[model samples]
Target: MPERELTFAQAVREALAEEMRRDSHVCIFGEDVAEAGTPFKVLSGLVEEFGGDRVVDTPISEAGFTGVAVGAAMTGMRPVVDIMFGDFLTLTMDQMVNQAAKVHYMSGGHWKVPMVMRTTLGATRRSAAQHSQSLHAWFSHVPGLKVVLPSTPYDAKGLLKTAIRDENPVVFFEDKMMYKLKGPVPEEEYTIPLGVAEVKREGDDITIVATSSMVQVGLGAATLLEKEGISAEVIDPRTTWPLDDKTLIESAKKTSRVIVLDEGYGRYGVTAELAAVIAEGAFYDLDAPVKRMGAMHVPIPFSPPLEDVTVATEETVFEAARQLCGKT
Candidate 1:
């Protein structure tokens, strides 16, 4: 269990490197992954180790390359497909939803797709609407797809390894805000199992369920709530698709109230999903109705101040929690 401090991007690169070295079937294909090594340097030096044939640099055709990756996965290759930005996933939705996700299930579980779809998300750099978005919600809504978001270096490495080896097509989201944040990650290899929720903080007053970048914001808000004598429990649903509703429901039953914070839009996004699930599973334990806070349903703005308002943050989480606890 030896550990080293590394940024989120470095952790992702390490996971890919380790997987590629261990399995010959593991190949990476993405635009600029070979030469430019990705905008966040997540694939830096991978081409040198795995060579150009394995670390392929595809054209800008997301649809074509994604479909190609799906076909490769079906035939026994474990391809780590990288979409430059989560926003561009829309172009390959048909291939991902109809093909990659559904193929194995449609085939009566006889076939398995061990493919990982890696993409960068969030708007910390002000990349605007086209390049910046938290679209895990989209992938989560589709059945047969696994969605994962790692907020720390350790989880980033372990979850990516799990996604690479998983039997189903997984959409792995790396929040741009976490790319530079450093944390303790193991030197030896490890994999975090999917369909699990990690309770980062435990408390009895209120429960905060967050995903992706909002995990950090929820933690920050939890600290402030602690000072005000409001104990806050924070839960990160690391994998969104097969969400660990049992853990969340148990926590909510103890606390009797829940607030869901998400980086995606408020309407029909990750937050919406959590709220719906809690309402369904833990309705009797509620002191008040479940609450959700997230970015407005509009496109991400460019200005820093505007972006601050558009995305969920500590203020938003605090207000939502306060309202749920009857302290607002």
Candidate 2:
């Protein structure tokens, strides 16, 4: 299969279009998703291709539309519900946590809520506190929900397709800052299996486990580490829930040093969870403490300078790696 360069948002749109074409049951609904094509224009022109019936533009009611999607999924429709902003997800907690997530388990496996809840995360676009957030950890803590945060265009397309086909409710998070980021994506059909992790770069000196946009930041840090003669391995846990612990544990065992990075708050966030998993599974492999880096606990500010300080950057990651390698 030949590969072509595509932005992260374009890859996501391709996945949605391809899945809708493959399955008559698949449909997408959200605020401004049809004619307006979303603020990012990811769904631009999709409504024209699929028609308004399949590509719906709903009222600005997160709870109402989310509930409708859940009900539709129960009746055999694969509905992709888009939450324009991660903060808006708070309004649909009942539909997401209680109903959609637990329907299959509550029904003794007789029913399934095969739905995808896609939302944008991260800070840096000056969207302010309401629109900028990395809340994957909140959903990951829920048992019945599958949490996925894809870092690259390839993973974004493949994982989203898999999420749409999944039998369980999937909370698919997209880093808002990565929308224009481009990468190679094959034209051929493909679906990356859920609960799997990918090793973006292999090394033996230390390991950097990152999520969403942090994966790119970690890779940049690894490049700097290389100049200092430090071989830093990079791992992206594509899905937060049912994380690919095997790959992470093996990498920790090989490197014996780990730095977990995320865009969520550092306190009790996804990085903390990854550190716990590594300590529990590979406690004997540790040469030093597992360092975790994430955004500061303050609300994301609208000011560019303050926002830059709040979120993790390549320099922050690079310094974390240096300190772990005893070079700082």
User: Top model by TM-score, which number?
Assistant: 2
TM-score of 1: 0.97
C-alpha lDDT of residue 287 in model 1 = 92
Model 1 residue 93 lDDT score: 97
- Measured against the true structure, the TM-scores of the candidates, in listed sequence, are 0.97, 0.98
lDDT of 1 by residue, 94-151 (tens): 9999998899889998887889999978886888889888888899989899999988
Q: Alpha carbon lDDT of residue 275, candidate 1?
A: 93
1-328 per-residue lDDT for model 2 (tens digits):
4569999999999999999999999999899999999988989988999999999999999999999999999998999999999989999999999998889999999998999999989999899999998888989989899999999999999999999999889999999889999999988899999899999999999999999989999999999889989999999989998799999999999999999999999899998999999999889989999999988999999999998999778888888788888886
Alpha-carbon lDDT, every model: 0.90, 0.93
Model 2 CA lDDT for position 185: 94
What ranges in model 2 sit over 4 Å off?
Answer: none
Q: Pull out the clashing pairs in model 2.
A: none
